[model samples]
Target chain A: MAKKTPLDPAAAFRVPSGLAELSAIDPAGTPIGPQDKESGAAALADLGPDLAALQEKLYAGATGGSEHRSVLLVLQGMDTSGKDGVVDKVLGLVNPAGLRLASFKKPTPEELAHDFLWRIEKQVPAAGLIGVFNRSQYEDVLVVRVHDLVPPAVWEPRYAAINDFEQRLTDSGVTVVKCFLHISKEVQKERLLARLDDPTKFWKYNPGDVDERGYWDDYQAAYLDALNRCSTDAAPWHVIPSDRKWYRNWAIGALLHQKLTELDPQYPPAEFDVEVEKGRVAAS
Target chain B: MAKKTPLDPAAAFRVPSGLAELSAIDPAGTPIGPQDKESGAAALADLGPDLAALQEKLYAGATGGSEHRSVLLVLQGMDTSGKDGVVDKVLGLVNPAGLRLASFKKPTPEELAHDFLWRIEKQVPAAGLIGVFNRSQYEDVLVVRVHDLVPPAVWEPRYAAINDFEQRLTDSGVTVVKCFLHISKEVQKERLLARLDDPTKFWKYNPGDVDERGYWDDYQAAYLDALNRCSTDAAPWHVIPSDRKWYRNWAIGALLHQKLTELDPQYPPAEFDVEVEKGRVAAS
Candidate 1:
């Protein structure tokens, strides 16, 4: 008999609906993974082949001109929440040809001129691709809210706007997996200090990261609103406990693997007469 | 003391100057790796960490706004010559975020309206990114020559134009690594048959591939001319013997690793005052 899989990652990591605040889930907890660090990384390694195979089927179909489905993983976290690490270890398992990655930093003058969703729309995964957005539409809600960059009237409606955008994506065969990498304030201090401690890591340090720490509570409030309002049947928010780097990597890898498995893309059947093709090749 | 290293991959794989015939090198030869299959795969695994580390430095330097250097890997070959396989196995060794891959198929009507290099130029690797062009500007010369799609006056002069284009890429802090995945005519027949026998791989089989097979000598002549003419100091062509899939993967992996190592990207120094930021982070 097959061993029972652990809890559905969908249910295990799904942010609860009607959530009141951000303090509910333990940032250090491993809700659906091995209880230790080494096993977490090992588990991620175990997922590589299956992930790659599934991705290839999808890639084959797309490149073969027969498929039009895609997946988009949206990553959101406060500064130093390990979004980049998750991408390297987790999403990195699949072929890059089938993957599209976009990182949204502060808006440039051109980006600022457009509607928030304008640039986001352009980067949505093409058919058969799996796209990742390092920081995404949620930024308009979180950062914009925390800094009062826009009045509540403007920021308040974006949750609905985001949900509608995600709904449209799903309607067009896109599966959206939005993850909020949850890290504690103490962890942020440690990560920043560690970056400062290593000369090789100094480039990762931004003084603004420390300045943003002062807005930790504000970001959490904004994130709570995002999770509660936008989490829907079409695309739900998954709060990946990111305090442990190993656990964070494992969880995101597991979630993405689970999503791709659910899609179960298949190679398109032979378009030509197989016997005729074989005869032609044999002769040539 | 360190162990003796193998012949410089740079020299071992580079196509000879003034090559007038495609038959000069055996397409099935493994000139630069372990003669056995298992060791070839094992060797690629050994290069993974160094490849990943070097990629991180380039990614960091670019993302951190301190580096302008990038590498472009242009892959050109006949159908089923293992270009896609090399990308999956060799280029796949690096971080996906730092890697940019562009697969150029036949040009669209809009693309045809512009100079051949227009589309190729737009996709050149940005600063701090390693880009792979699955099929590139060389197609203009190779296929255009074989099909007589353009007159001698037009296609013949493309060699000089390509040289000028690549030279410009080098002058702008780009290192171009051009590889021609050389597979024999017999191997293509075998590979096409293999795809026919395997149902799952049928998506990869194209009817036109057989049509192209009929033009083998014409294509080979075209290739030799393009290889000899376009092979330049700015970006020489590396003729990878690709009959053994394992060796092809290893050779390309080794060549790319060697190229990245040669670029020697550095992690940028601290852009902010470290002690001051440390104090701010600690206090917060």
Candidate 2:
């Protein structure tokens, strides 16, 4: 008999040993099914409506007062690894009315004044919405570690703090899906060159992106440390191969689709007599 | 000779006397140009690309370190009066990358621990982004006053506090555009009934919305008081008649388009020699 495939997509790319080297994973690898770009695209297209329907159920359940569950998709990626593209393609599959997107840029003075998680806690999706953090609390460790923004003693403890924080969120009905969009350095260079070649893309081509490219090895090491330290049972980190945008989008979408399906959010039973309300409305 | 039309949309519906009663403005009034729905839609369509272009300039200028301007569109409206619809239609005209949306729901326990504006302050758009607040700080006065969530002594001082807060935002690079979506009780009733009749929209129809309908008079009074007290030179409030969704959407689009045109954010010159960079990129 064929070996049973893991039902949980999280099983495939999860940093299981908590010490998986980032360099071991191929940025162009397609770890899950569909084998090729066309099939992967087809699978994603098939899952779109299912995802939308599940979102509606989650929304209905929240409003109907039967369920208070929500999901937070935390995306951490290098420049040109298709974070925004994933947002536009995958999360964009659902009703945007129920989706909240928070992109964490550099910390403002006020944000810097508080603990790193203060701003993040405030932006966590309220009970029924799917919250997408384009870049999130992980930056506290990732960027801060790379740039020496804070001393090692300050940034080091945050891994445990983040685990505790995410655990609390899970306890309070939030399922955290953290994804690291892993891209090869060569692919990033090509993407950057493409941005330079195209004028329309120039708006997105920041000189800082090129500067950050120089720190690629440092960022990868920082990311590996973060993944190992913080990937808990409650919020496991998934390192997705992102050199192929199609596979990356599909993988994330498929993972979200599986998670929502597992959640099985139901449309709540009517609190009032639906038939009576229908009758009243018809009479009115 | 024909009287010169007011080029600024703010001139028409800006709470002029501050005592201009909510009851005095017709919820169905078409105060701006187009007399019909098609014309209003056409106007909105015409303004879309202009708005997009202005947003691009604002973003480009911010990145290029030449401009630091941003706009905050604060939308306050009754339930079923179309705040989200306006967000979808009007504010959706710009690039999502440049737009940040913060929807202030019922305060979380942590949010309650701080001053009301604490969470709000964290969500304000940074330089070069348009921040849209759906049901913003005004709620401290509006819902808190109507629902008796806090003592009058607690909520009353908030009007002045809000004016001060907005003044500070304006003193910085942020331009505050506060809009009150004004719709009649009759229109609200029709909207509520429509939601009841359509199963597809049931997710949006909270039973509490019907209960809130009973508080119509109190809400209007709360809105009027808030509008009168908070409209200021830096952050004037525009009461948009929202009985017609199309007109509301168009009026807001036109207003934003006009405001952005007035700001006329310019693209900053390249920080490095463009020709040299292009040569370097080509050589690489």
Candidate 3:
């Protein structure tokens, strides 16, 4: 077997080539963005306006007579890893009109009748919108594998299917940004305990969460396999340290801001004579 | 024609019998809950722990083999009336695992192939869950009527169809709470302008919003018709004054809190003997 070369910090955060082990990356380490909490929060606030602006341009271009391109932010995390918080704090900065938030729960009987992605494909954001999948197609591999919902023969081929599905999305003008919110078992335990301690937080305290905690190693292994197999250049996965809520929010926000800035979407030019329309409106 | 009896404040916020003109309701008025913003926020915070506890009990009862009952919060509002905000601020307080958030956008070709309710029924929450519909089946009537997407004969009967559908859900263990976030035409224009002024808010600004504004009266009429026809004792429509964001969030939160409290779900007893399970665990 050929020896694998070490990846830079950026590459380290993402899945590396060959058999990548999630154990190599620290869930508590901030590989990208500010190391301190205050600075991380400040950075997130600074990027908010730019992200909002860029998202608008993308929305306008798609809605107007111009090329339509959009971004899909897929979030996957263990229980209490702040996926919901990320959606509220980071993605919430953008205009809700152009932002489509889809939270995928367990598959329904009808959804089970079809392929796993059947329900997901329907929720994809239209041209000029930002689609945020609270939990996404990746759950087919992660949760399904962890729970032994299907046989290996059923789920083993999903990696390639996911890659192909994403590639098609990319080819059709959607930018797919996947993030795995990594939190240590200790952090998760603390969060769970806090929920139990506060009466107001009781709604969030599920007994199932405690049961699932026992399968930590199994889930990590499943995630490692997924990252190694499905993290292609087209839609690579970013493993974000989520122990610190501030860093998690900042990193995801900055990552999205960078992606949108790179896309540099512009407002579409007027299809008709603007001056004439302006005059007509004024007279009316 | 007989003279319609005057309604009390609570009944007034709800649709009155007869024509039930939208023009009669004051969008700026806070018909229920705290009269002021500071008090509303405080009251919402005060109810947090109770709401959370009630929701947890509801979830636990369903999951633990007790009588299963869930709440479906259907939120409908015109552009800029803060339907998304209600989901975030009011509903976001609950645990995401037990909460299902579904945002309905423009229907795809596949969705259009079937009846409008087909797509909605799929997204209904399972037992032990609270389902929040950002936009819902009501759109079939509101937007369809406004745009003439369907003929009068097609859209006309849908009012009764919707009434029947909701009645069926009520017949099941589901408690449906429908809210229409009512805002003035002037307020919407102000919000649109604010989005345009802030670059970050550009993503939220849709030129089509202005076009839709042209059909303001038509939408109001459609909403009035839906309210008068569909507000049954099973699933009542609450017209919320949404011009104030804080009050809107508080009102919806309070409303949900009231409903769940009334349900008063109790956690189920252990299926197995506690002492035996404890002994087994200790032995293992």
Candidate 4:
């Protein structure tokens, strides 16, 4: 028998994780087990320890480092996909100074008149800051796609534009991590019903959500297309199966920590003479 | 001699913690502690544990309850006050999903045309969320007072409008915690200088801050007046001394947690049928 070779880390990295499979409109079945040979589950678990270490690195870096390369995490997910929960948990790990969030919804008439990206661009983190976008420009893709607010041809061009845009950001040193939380229709229905029954949640139970729910298949198809086209080496999409909130949080946090540590932003190179700093301090 | 009386917690809380006394416009008179203590040292310490607890409560509440009341924390402060640092630290403690941030700046021509509060209203927290405003509607007072943008008569009416707006919110169960990070002019200059001298922080340094510093006396007078008049029983203003970044974080965190815990939004009174919940799960 021929000798079986072991998997190398680089080769393993190239094999798309279950994240990609889940992101597809029609995902192929994969075997699941405690060891998680399945790409999605393993990728999700892989994020844990790296997330913890990166979190510690970020906190220390924020307080002690003069120049920190800030990161912005943008999450776009379907209603039941758990954007809020993901954000709350993942960001809990980073230092507060280094993290901020902007959640975008239906823009007013004034917002509509301006370019779609205008309001979003203003929300990006300045250098050395981390900004998270709960629903980002991809809204131009998913929401716009589902609603047909923009023609197919119009948004078709946007895929390349978005890829270029994200690449520019990556080149400029903005580590952009994007996640699309994927949940099954059955799970979504249960959540919707929960929202409807509770009075406090009645505020969140928009009649519109029901209307939107009818078009679930369309939305799923739209998301798959967006993921397939927009997913790039620069800003890869992690399609998280969020039927489990705990698993989702761990996966997202791990992905973020991995991307940030890879960037490895360093402390400011210039240092002041201690005596001079003291003298300047005294003078002030 | 008559027995000396000791201060109670409420009485002690009123004793000012020697914050203002420690703040001298001149560094020569300011006591240099391990960390910058002239302004924020005491205030931060007071609020730290409370903020930590609030973060945990926010997560616990988010997970267990089907319904949660969203909270908005507005931080309005003078230039040298630690608004950014406070946000950097206090927000550091919470689950990110529960938090959103809006940092109001010079309004665009579009923003200027609308009623000032229109933009702010859109930023308010949704049910079960928390929103933070770096600078808010009080800008109508702070900037207007200093710049004389509107006549006193017009601006004065806003105080009533502001009170009514807040009352409406409290009546609807929206709890607002507003903090004014108070720092002395002397401390402001030291931090501003630190920004100037450090290459990495140079981006944060604006010549405009110096120009504004020239008007320090005018701005301080305006804030004191606004704080006195607008600080209401419903949404009382906590004037946090912010010379020490760590202390400021703690005080602001503590104040917010105390307020949120007091609100104590619980699970809705109506119970969900276990069978129905199970059926919904089964159907999914």
The candidate scoring highest on TM-score is 1
Query: What TM-scores do the predictions have?
Result: 0.97, 0.74, 0.69, 0.63
Better of 2 and 4 by DockQ: 4
Q: Write the per-residue lDDT of candidate 2 for residues A1-284, one digit (tens) a residue.
A: 11222456788878767575798998999877777889989978778778878887888788765688899999999999998888867875676567888889999999999999999999899887889999999999988999999999999899999999999999999999999999998888788778777654565677677668778889999999988888989999998999998899889988898788778887766566556554443443
Under CAPRI classification, how is model 4 graded?
incorrect
TM-score comparison, 1 vs 4, better candidate:
1
Counted clashes in each candidate structure:
0, 0, 1, 17
Top DockQ model = 1
Quick one: ranking by lDDT, best first? 1, 2, 3, 4
Best by lDDT: 1
Candidate 4 lDDT over residue span B1-284, tens digit each? 11111212112112132234323222222122224444445544444555544544443445455545667788887675778766656675566656677888887888878877788888887666678889998888778767888789878777777777777776665677777776777788788777756655544444456667767777777666566666666766656656666656655655566566665554343344444543544444
Higher-lDDT candidate of 1 and 4: 1
List, for all models, the DockQ compared with the true complex: 0.74, 0.15, 0.10, 0.18
Candidate 1 vs candidate 2: which has greater DockQ? 1
lDDT (tens digit, per residue) of candidate 4 on A169-210: 878767777777768777788777777555545434444566
Q: Where in model 1 is the C-alpha error above 4 Å?
A: A1-4, B1-6
Superior candidate under DockQ, 3 versus 4: 4
Q: Report i-RMS for every model.
A: 1.3, 3.9, 6.4, 7.4
**Which residues of candidate 3, in runs, are more than 4 Å off?**
A1-12, A16-21, A31-67, A74-161, A180-225, A241-254, A264-284, B1-12, B30-67, B73-116, B123-156, B181-222, B242-284
